[model samples]
Structures are given as C-alpha cells and as structure tokens.
Target: MRDLEGRYVNCCSLRYGLSFFIHFCNIAIAAQRVCLSLTMVVMVNTTYSHELHNSSTNELLTNVKNPVYDWSPETQGLILSSIFYGAAIIQLPSGYLSGIYSIKKIVGCGLFLSSLCSLLIPLAAAFGKTSVIVCRVVQGIAQGMASTGQHEIWTKWAPPRERGRLTSICLSGFLLGSFIVLLVTGFICESLGWPIVFYIFSAYGGVLCLLWFVLVYDDPKDHPCISISEKQYITSSLVQQFSSSQQSLPIKSMLKSLPIWAISFATFGYFWSNTILFLYIPMYINSILHVNIKENGLLSALPFLFAWICGILSGQMADFFSSRSILSTTNIRKLFTTLGLLLPVLFSMCLLYLSSSYFSTVIFLILASATGAFSLPGMMINALDIAPRYYGFLKGVTILVGMIGGLISSTLTGIIINQDPESPWFEVFFLMTAVCLACLIFYLIFGEGEIQEWAKERKHTRL
Candidate 1:
C-alpha cells in the first residue's frame, strides 16, 4: 500500500512539472525586449554602412525599394536614448502596479503592446526619425512594465533555496537574446533587409506573449494544472520566507538604507558599461576593424555568449556555496560583486592600451563582459536577500537609476564619437574603469545579504 501511494505521488509530481516548463517561457519573455532593442542597433549600423558605401545617390534612392533614413549621429543618439527615457518613467509605477495587481496580465499586455510597436517600426522609420523614436518610446514603456512584472513573478514562484539558479537562468536570457539578435540581424540585413529583422523578432514576441498567458499564473494556488503536492511544496516554502499579506512598501526606510543605495549605484555603473558595449560594439567593429556585416554580427555576439555561460556557472557556484555553508551569503555576494566590477575595469584598461590589435581588443571585450556576469548571483539577486517582499519594487528603482546611466552613456557616446571616430578611445575606457571602481568600493562598503529590519518587521507583524 505504501509503495502504491509513493507511485501515485510520483505521478502527481510529474503533473507539477508544468511549472518547470513555464520557467522556459519566462526566459522567452525576458528575451523579448533585449532582442528588439539590439535589433534596432544592428539595423541602424547596417543601414548607415550601406549609405556610406553607395555613391550613386539618385540611382540608389530610386532603385532601393526600401530606403534607409539619413539621420545625423546626434539624431541617432536621440533615437537610442528615447527608449530609456520612457523606460525610466514607467519603471516605478509598473512595479507598484505588479505588486498590487495581476502580474500575469500586466506583463502579458506589456509584451503584446511592445510586439505591436516593433512590428510598426519599419513603417515608423519610413515616415521619419521622430516616428521611429515614438515607436521605440512606446516599446520601452511596455518593456519596463514587463521587466518589473518578471521580478514580481519570482517573488511568488521561486523557492528560496533555488532563487540564485532560477533567477540566473531567467536573466541569462538577456545575454542570449542579445546574442541571437546580433548574430541573426546581420545575416537578415544582408539577405532580406533591416525591416525583416524587426518583423521576425516581433513575431517571436507575439508567440511568447501568447505562451505566457496560457502557461503562467501569479501563484501556485492559482495554477490549474499544478499537482496538489507541488502546490503544497511551493506554498510551504514561500510561507516560511514571505509575508502572507501585502504590506505597504517602506519607501522612506528603503530610500534611507545604505545597502539599497549600494545596489542602485552599482547597477548604474554596470548599465553604463553594458550600454556602451551593446549599442556601440557593432559600430566599433564596422568602423575600426572594417568587418563586414556578417562578421560584425558574429564578433559582437561573442561577449554576450560568454557572459551567458558565465552567469549560469556563477549562479550554480553561488548556490553550492550557500547550500554548503562554505561562505556567508554576505561574503559570497561581496566576493562575486567585486570580481564582476573589478575585472571589467582591468579589461577596459587593457582595451585602452591595445585598441589597435583587433584580436587583443576582442579578447578583452569578451573577458570584460563575461566577468560582469558574476553579478547575477551577487548584487542582482541581493534584493531578494534583503527584501523578498519588495524585490520587484527594489529592482524597479535600481533599474530606473540604471536606465539613466544608459541614457547618458548612449547619448555621450554619440557626441564623443561624432566629434571624431578615431578620437583617442583612452578617455572613454578610463571613464568606464573609474565608474566600475567607484561602484565596487561603494558596494563592498555598504552591501548586505541579510534581510532588513523593515522586512523582518512586516513578517513578524503578520505572524
């Protein structure tokens, strides 16, 4: 009888595996914005390269069925910066709403809208620069909400012990998405044209939005197909870690917290460096190395691919150490965070000195990006450690600040590079190094892995 019961439970457990499948879907959703955003970068660079080479202006304009928009570098910067401007505006409100309302619907709708905007981008570009910026801004607003909603999902779904691995798996999609876009967009541009890149990625977003609605639920209790055993397992794990009722976010206290500031500032630094890599790497490859579009795509993708692998490996190592009690969570967080920031600084310095050697520069770029992936299990997951209940809100606040860094970096790169493409890249490399160093110092000083008093108080009061 006991054996029979065990078999029955095992069968039920298989039914519960549906939620595991949903994790992959979550990855797809996470990938959507990244793919769309970088696709634009690839498209713009390819179009600009085309314009530069084609000398028969009248014949080219007339013969080319779909003409690329001729925008100055400054205007291109504005278009790139516009997305982050909209993203920053929506981050806080979207987080708040996801916490209070249905995360599934909020995220689903956001992705759907963003997908629609992506589909319309080709049309917008045909109209003019302003039109393309408007489309990108709308997409950014939608993706901001979607991103916050994803963090909120983790609060409800991620088991405390498995948080590092699960969150890393989800976040790694960003790098994967970037890799795919950079690699594929180049070939797509060469074969089909830039417009097809937008259409293909938008279609992917549409499919993911549909899958999200079908497979995902806010909590275990709401999942129709989840077996009772799995539901009990999830509910039991979360109940121990989280408050049953939603409490008002201690905004004032959060703002006053040293650790929160550390996370935000560190995130700002990471974003500044990452934005430069993502938005400008294609241009760098084209302008400096004189690589063709296909080679440019493959080369640009290498760093992100390395980063994705490193992120997964670091996450597993973090979980192993935590499980074994080999290191305090605080120390682990600090160790990885330091490595992530410090190595990138060193790599950037190497780039400053060796920019002329294409092979050496590529190696440094890949190393810089890969080392930064250590932060996935470090500062990126630190919010759940300090405030699981408000992880979404905290992530939103940090990302809002980070987007400001992205905005400044993107615009500033345009201005500086426009002045002279061959200008000494040393200053830019030095600035990246300094930003990384400062953030590392601040995080090492103030970052914590312990839950804050405010979070503990809320849980205690509920008890």
Candidate 2:
C-alpha cells in the first residue's frame, strides 16, 4: 500500500510539470508573433507619414483663397524648407542613439511621437507661427529615428541572399509611401484642409505603436514568433557576413574609414537633388515661375511617380549583378552611386535654363529622378555589405551628413529665391551641379568594397 501511494504521487508531479512547460512555450510564441508584427508596423507608419504630406504640390498653392499665412513666393519656399530643416537636425542624434541602445525601442518611439507631431501641425497652424514651427520641429525629431533604426534592423535581421530584395522593398517605401501620401493627402486636403492631415496620423500611428509595444524584441535569440526553421535560416546566412567578433563595434575605426567617408560625402550631394525635387519644387513652380496651383501639384508629383519605375529596376539590377557574379560587392555599389550622382548634376544644370519650357523641365526632372535608383547599389547597400555590425553607427554618420546637405541646400535656396525670384534660382542649380561633380570624383578614388578586408585584418592583428 505504501509503495503504491508513492508511485502515484510521482506520476502526478510529472504531469503538472509538463503542463507548466507547455503553457510557458505558448506564451513565448505569442510574444514573438507580436514582435515580428510590430517590426512590420513601424514601416507602415513611416509610409503613412510620407503619404500625408505628399499633396504639397497640389494643395499648398491652390487651397489658399484669402492667403492668411503669407504665401509669397519667398515664404512658400521657407515653409516647404522648414520641414526639412527639422528632419536634418534629428538625423544626427537618432543615428547615434541606435549605437548605444536597441534600434527597435528608438524606432517604436519615433513612429508614435511623429504621429503626434503630425496630429498637432494643423492645430499649431491654426494658433499661429509659434505652433507651426514647433510642430514641424517635433515632426523632424521623430523622423530622425527612422534612417538609423532601419539600417540597424537591416544589419541585425536581414540575410545576405535576400538582402538586396528586402532593402529594395524598404527603400521603395520612400516613394511608395510618398505615392500613398499623395493619394490620401491630395484627397484629404482637397476635402478637409491641411489640418486634417495630423488628425489622421493621430488615429493611425497611435494604434500601430501600441501594436509594436506588445510584439517586438531586440535580438533573435529571444524572439518568440520566429519558427525554428526561420531562426536557423536567418542566423546561418547572416552570421557569416560578420567575422567572429563579440566585441561592440569600434566607432573610431569605422568613422576613420575612407570608403565610409566617401559614401557620406556622396550622399551629402545627392540629398540636394532629392530635397529640391521632393520638398522645394512646389514653390519653384507656383511662386518663382508662376504656374497655377492645380497644375503644379501634378507636375511636382510626377517626378516621384516616374521614379517608382526606376526604384524597382534599381533594386532588381542590384540583385541581378550580385547573383550573376559579374561585379564584386564594392564595384556594384559604386556603379549605382556614380550613375545616380552624375545624371542629376546634368539635369539640374539644364533645369536652370529649361524652366521657361514646361515640357523640357518636366522631362529633365523625370529623367533625373529615375537615376537615383543607381545609388541603391552603392550607398544604400554598401552599409550592409561592408560592415553589417557597425552599420548602425555608420548610418548615423551618413544621416547626420546627409541632413547637413539638406540644411545647406534648403537654407541656401531659401536665401537665393527670396533675394531675386527671376534669375538667381539658376545659380542654385549651378552650385549644386558643381558640388555633385566634386562628389563624383570622391567616389572614384576612395570608396572601394574591400574596406571590410582592411577592418578585418586590423581586428585579427589586435587579437
């Protein structure tokens, strides 16, 4: 009787232990699903924000009847440029923040906070300049988290075989987000006025942030939703791109690298073209050149619409070259950078002369916009290819420098357009052209793909 009771108790204890283990596993799996989902949602919000402001060309000029906010050609340029100034200032800190902390947390916070800024903008404008610039600055600070965080996630999570395609997809969001933004903001501003833009973000972005908070974890070892197959797939492929080092990436070494500096410098020039087209074109059309507001929206939006084709082609081209073994990683990246940079220089130079002919202006703008895809190979992908571990820091450096480019372009253009609306705008294009050529020479000499080799050799000797 005693032996029988002891055996039964042992069996019951084993059953309870098994049940507890099963419950823990279920909770863990659910948590991972949440993380993966949130990871995706962050980009969705980014795309949404891009969409919200997309109506700049259409709504900004035409919607004004009484013109209370002072829509002079000069001020219009200032207003458009204001948002970018905010964006540039944030990029420096956001990039560096990722190196010190988790990318996921920073990005998650950014999405939610930017949404609030988006929500507040219309309210601020309603109140006056105190509100408007403050909200714009807030939006800029929120957005700063994106570029650095995105690069950090890419370096941490993405696999080499699929790296180009995945990157392209994320990169495509810049245009696609703008596309979606154009479609929504155009309709909303047409019906609701610009104030409603932030309202929409408040509702949408807040929900997405809530989802991210529950789901995302920083590292793969802890992530719950990832199946064993997926985990093995991600790790086996990605881990080798990094040499065997558990040490935190040395910032000094990365900052000093010539290739990294080349990409940074090159990006500085390219951003001038990007900002002029995306952020500043509306004023150029409506105030300086005297195009109607309705026509200006479609015209300003057209270049980005056209670039959609190029963005896709550029990504595919990047993958195609690598898969075929035609160019090493470095050369492939350089090819895109070289082409994207040079074409814009030419088109922008012509733009100064061609603004009189609307058709020629549009054509050059579209052609130039399409060439930006070329950088997909070099500046975009090289961060991952050359040093995945340190990409977070490098991305911060690049983002900081790029924002400075925007600041210079926007500030300079603001002064130029304000001074003499008729002719000096040509000088802005000319100055940018000279700068782009200087950047082209830079990439040719310094930004080789073999930079990782130099880094690895240094690491080995120290060991």
Candidate 3:
C-alpha cells in the first residue's frame, strides 16, 4: 500500500512538470508563429516591387501595349501604395474588436483571408491592373487585422518587467520577415516565376494560421493545457505589476492627450522613412549600384538581418534596465527613441553625399537600419507603457496615421524617381531626414511612460 501510494504521488509530480514545460514552450512558439505571419504579409506586399523592377516586364504583362497591363515604374508604385489604403481603413476596427472579443479568432481569420488574397493575386494580375489593385487592398485589410490582434495578445501574455523584451521578440519578426522575403523572393521569381512566390508564401500563411489556432489562447486562464502552478505564477506576476483596471476606452480623453499625439507623430515619421527604405532599397541598389537581380536580393537583405539582431539585443537590454531599476521607463523609452530616429536621420543625410561611393553607401544603409532597431524597445513599446489596457486601440491609431506616411512616400517616390532618375533621390532623402527630425523634437517634448489616468478604471465603472 505504501509503495502504490508513492507511485501515484510521483505520477502527479511528473504530470505537473510536463505541463510547466508545455507552458514555457508556448512562449517560444507564439513568437515563431507571429514572425511567420509577418513574413507572409511583407512577402506578399513587396514581392511585386522586385519582380516588376528587375524581372522581364513582358512576362509580367498580359498585353504590353495595353496601357493598363504595362508594368511601368508608376504602375508598380501605385500597386505598392494601394495596400496601405485598405490597411489604414481596418486598423481602428480591428484593434477595437481584438480588445472586446477574441484575439485568437481575429488574428486567425485575418491571416487566413490575407493568405487567400495572396493566392488570388496571380489571377488578379492576369485580369488587369485594377483587379490587381483591388486584390492588394483586400490583402491589406486582412493583414492589418492580423497585426493589430497580435499586440492585444502581448498585453495578456507579457509580464510588466519583460514587456520590452517580449514585445521586441514579437516585433523582430517584422524585420526577419522582411529579410526572408527580400532574400528569397528574388530567387523564387527568377526560378519558378514571380507568381510562384505569392503561392508559396500564401500556403505557408495557411499552415501558420492552423498552428496559431491550436497553440494560442486569449489569456492564461483560458489555456486548458497549462499547469496550475505555471498559471498561478503568470497570474501573480501580472497582477502585482501590470494589472489593468479594465476601464472602458476613453476615446475623447485619448485624442486630446498630447502624449498620444506625440507617439502618433513619431511613429508616422518612423514609418515614412522605413517604408521608403525597405520598399525601395532593392530598386535603389539595382539602379545606382547596377547589381543584378540576385546581388540586389542578397545586398538588400543584409540591412534587415543586422536590424533584426540589433532589435533583439536592444529589447533584452531594455528589459534588464527595467528589472534592475537602473533607469526610469520614461528615460529609457526617450533615449532609445532618440537614438533610433536621430542616428538614422544622420545616416540618411550622409547618403546624399555618398551617392558616388558604392561601399560607403552600403555601410550607411546597414547602420541606418541596424540602429533603427532601437525603436522596437523605444517608441514601439511606449504605447504599452502608457496604456496597458488600451494598447490595442493606441497601436491601431498610431499605425493608421503612420501608414499614411507609407502611402505618401511610396506614391511620391514613384512620381519623383520617374520624373528625373538622377537628382530626384536627393529630394526624397531630404524629405525623409526632415520628417524624422521634426517628429523627434515633438516626441522628446511630450512623450510619457507612465500609465494614463484615462486608461484606469474608476469607481462604479465597468470596462
């Protein structure tokens, strides 16, 4: 009887241990899947930019003489810009839905729809430019929902101390996705044809969506397979440091807040420069450096690879500072935000003078991208710091405003570059630099790291 009872106790212990391990694994899996989803969206959006600019236009077009199907520089720019229109429209709605309803369902449905749209792109292109633009718009809407939903998940999963690192880990997926797409899309287009790039990436998205549905839960309490001990640990940690009062969103208050506007403007400047650099880097390399398609792919990917590493390191460092109480959260956010924006501004300005030297130009590009990684732990996480409960809504608003910068940059680049290939770049680079400086000044004056009163629950009020 003694031996039998001992065995039963041991079995219980083993079961608890296994559950704890599974809980740990969930964090890593969540990060990986989010990275994959980001890769899918970025891959689909940027694939055509390289294909149209570098590949044979005759192959891409159904009728070269039919103005609608002609893959001109202007047409390529418009198509890239079109996605932002749809993305901007859905950001607010998606964030509100994620906060109020099931984050898992919103993310899964969005990714599935985006993947479906990607598969339809090849067919849409065959129809006409208008059809292709429509497909991109639909794709943008789905991806916007998916991206916004992920932030809501972080609010539930990330502990207060680990917020910077964990959020960075999740967002680093953006850089990684961009890197993978830039590196592989060129080869895929060259070998299997550009259409295959969309098909393969879309298929991967479908697979990732299935995995996300199986693995993720909306909150720790909802995860069936998690151990009681692990769940308690998570709950206790969160409750002590990051508990939200679950207040109803105070939209009027938020809009009137200067700190919120600072975040918005800062993000707008960051995205403006980022969109121009990422979307056009390959084209820029091909045009100025005169590298072949394969070289352009490899070279363009290098900046993103460095940026991903830098982003992860910055995140870890930010978490360390917070955990050890080395610096106030506000100072940490501001310092890094300045480093991320200011360094890139200087680097971009240097590009204007270094246009003649291939080696110098490449080095500056790498520095700009890698240093900009600081923004991950800086401005990107500021929304969470200021409004833990309302991060989804805040993120949605920031992204909505920010993506307009992307839209304008893309469309303007197309027009300017086409007007005069030689000197047009000067204006583009100058504009990016000026915008970054202005936003940086505004953020430094007004940004805050403490939770806003409006985000807290008041007596007798329900969230």
Q: How far is 121's C-alpha from truth in model 3 (Å)? A: 1.7
RMSD of each: 5.0, 13.3, 8.1
- Cα-based TM-score, every candidate: 0.85, 0.76, 0.82
Model 3: C-alpha RMSD to truth?
8.1
- Candidate 2 TM-score, true structure as reference: 0.76
Instruction: Give the winner by lDDT.
Output: 1
Q: By TM-score, who's the top model here?
A: 1
Quantify all predictions' global Cα lDDT against the true fold.
0.74, 0.60, 0.72
Candidate ranking (lDDT, best to worst): 1, 3, 2
Task: Mark the regions of model 1 whose C-alpha exceeds 4 Å error after superposition.
Answer: 1-65, 286-288, 354-357, 415-423, 457-463
Clashing residue pairs in candidate 1 are: none
lDDT of 3 by residue, 317-374 (tens): 9977876788899988888888888887788777777646889989887787677888
TM-score of 1: 0.85
